[model samples]
Target: MLAPFLIMLREGVEAALIVGIIASYLKQVGRSDMMPAVWLGILTAVALALFVGTGLQMVSAEFPQKEQELFEALVGVVAVAVLTSMVFWMRKAARSIKGELHASVDRALSGSAFALIAMVFLAVAREGLESVFFLLAIFQQSNDALAPLGALLGVAAAVVIGYGIYAGGVRLDLRRFFRWTGVFILFVAAGLLANAVKAFHEAGLWNGLQETAFDISHILPADGPLGSLLSGMLGYRDAPTVGEVIVYVVFLAATLIPFLAPASPATSRAAARPARQKV
Candidate 1:
């Protein structure tokens, strides 16, 4: 529940921010009349995301048990890849995103109404599709039926928070929020990677270091309150395979060290500067 909640919140807030910024930019440039088109694009992108996600889920539901395991492994792998790229992309793009978006709006307006719609759709679609994959992965791993509700609540909360920010009712340090949440997401991503490896092994595609790493079920059974929370959030297992443990630890180490480290002076300057290209 916690896992899906936080991830969806991040994705939703990002999408909302993009929409808000685009709307604000449009108004600033006396293009307020085009807001209906913006809304159209956003709604269309959202619909497409929902359709794609539902289609994937329904298709996956028809698979046999072994095929299902393999599909789960593939989806986890893709989710991890998408999530990692998104995290780094946000880290780099945050600094100049506004300027870049404004430029995009300018170019889009010069073309046609369809161009603006396409622009908005493409921008928000990335976030929506990313959220879909995250939800799929989380739903697959969760045992409780309330995970979907948790995800919906998270997205709702994000919408409210986004409105507050846009309306000047909330003053948030977005960089700080993203930085902390990024660490949390990276932890979750590590767990997903381990889960993917285990799924592959279950699918009979992996068989290396299959020995049990440790057993702590007596101390913290997965069904317990705390255990379940950790299991859902960090992919905790009472007794995991050696491969899973290795991947989990190694993934955390590789990602966390660089993510938590302070940006170099040159990198900071580069990020602070607006892009020279119109795009």
Candidate 2:
């Protein structure tokens, strides 16, 4: 529940931030007339994301057990990729995002509405698609029925928070927020990667080292309250396969080390700079 919420909140704020920045730039340059096109692009991107998510869900529902596991594994892999890229890309793009957006706006002003719409569409669609993948992955992993509600509320809160930032009512340290959340997201991604491996094994696609890594199922069942919490948030399988444990630990070591390592001078400076959300 909390996993999807935070993921969606982060993603939602990012999409909102992009739209806010573009809207502000338009007003600054006396091209506020272009705002409608920007919105149209955003809506179009949103529609595309919804269409894709719904289509995948509808198709996957008809699959047999093994095929469904394979499908889930595929979704988990894509979600991990999307989650990792979103975190690292934001770290790299934070500094130059405003300037790039401004440049795109300038180019759009020189051309046609199609250009402006395309720009916003592509930008927002990235976030939308990321959300779809992560959300679907979360839904696929969880046994809880309320996960969707948590996700919905997260998006709602993000919209409110994003608007507050844009309207000058919120003064969050976005860099810190993202840093903490990035840590959390890396943890989640590790869990997803492990689960994906487990799913692959279940689908009969990969069947090596099929030993039980550990068995705490008697004490902490995966479906119980505390167990489910850990399972959802940290991918804690009570009796995880040896392969699952190996991938989880290795993924964490690989990603967490680099993520927490010191940044270069240029990256430090750029990440130090706060996102300019106020008009």
Candidate 3:
């Protein structure tokens, strides 16, 4: 539940931020009349995300047990890849996001209404599709209604926060917010990687390394509530296979080393300037 909640909140906030930037740009340029098209595009993207999620869920449900495990493994792998890219991409792109958004708005306004709509659709749909994929992966891991409920709450909270930002009632340290969340997401992705490996092993797709690296089942079984939470969030395993342990450790270490590195002096100065200006 916690994992899904945080994931959805982060993803929702990202989408909201993009939409807010576009809307703010439109208003600033005296093109408020085109606002309807922006909303239309957002709606379309959201609908498409829901349709895709539902379709995937229905399709996966129809598979036999082994096939279901294989499906889960595939989804987990894809989610880890998508999320890893998203975190790094956002880190690189965050500095220029506002400028890029404004440029996009300018391009859209200069083009025909259809083009403008298409631009907005593409922007929102990018985030929407990401959310769909992540949620699918999470649901496969959770298999509980609570996870979806938590996600709904997270999205609702994001909407409220986004509205506050748009109304000038609140301000965010977006760089810090994203940095911390990105770190957390890396851990989650590591867990997903381990889970994916376990699923593949269970499906008999891989059997090269099936020995239990260590057994802690006596202290904490993976099926226990706390163990399950850790398993879902941090890839904890009571008696993990050698392959699962290797994937979890190697992925986490590789991704986190660069992520935890201090920002370069130039990057730090550049990030600081905006906050100083805001102050």
Best by TM-score: 1
Rank ordering of all candidates by TM-score, starting from the highest: 1, 2, 3
lDDT string for model 3 (1-279, tens) is 787788888888888898888888788889999999998888988999999989999999999999999999999998899899889888877876777777777888888877778888888888778878888888887645688888898899889888888889989998898899999999989988888998998888988788889999989998888888887677678998988889988998999888878779898678556534432
lDDT, candidate 1, 5-51, per-residue tens: 88888888888888888888888889998898898999999999999
Give the Cα-based TM-score of candidate 2 against the true structure: 0.94
Write down the TM-score of every candidate. 0.97, 0.94, 0.92
Total clashing residue pairs per candidate? 0, 0, 0
- Candidate 3 clashing pairs, residues 3+ apart or interchain: none
Model 3 error, position 157 (Å): 0.7
1-279 per-residue lDDT for model 2 (tens digits): 888888888998888888888888898889888889998999999999999999999999999999999999999999999999888888777766777787788888899999999999999999999989988888898776778988898889989998898888998787777877888999999889889998999999999978998999999999899999988887788998899989989988988788777689987666545434321
Between prediction 1 and prediction 3, the one with superior lDDT is 1
Q: What stretches of model 1 exceed 4 Å from their correct place?
A: 275-279
List candidate 3 stretches off by more than 4 Å: 265-279
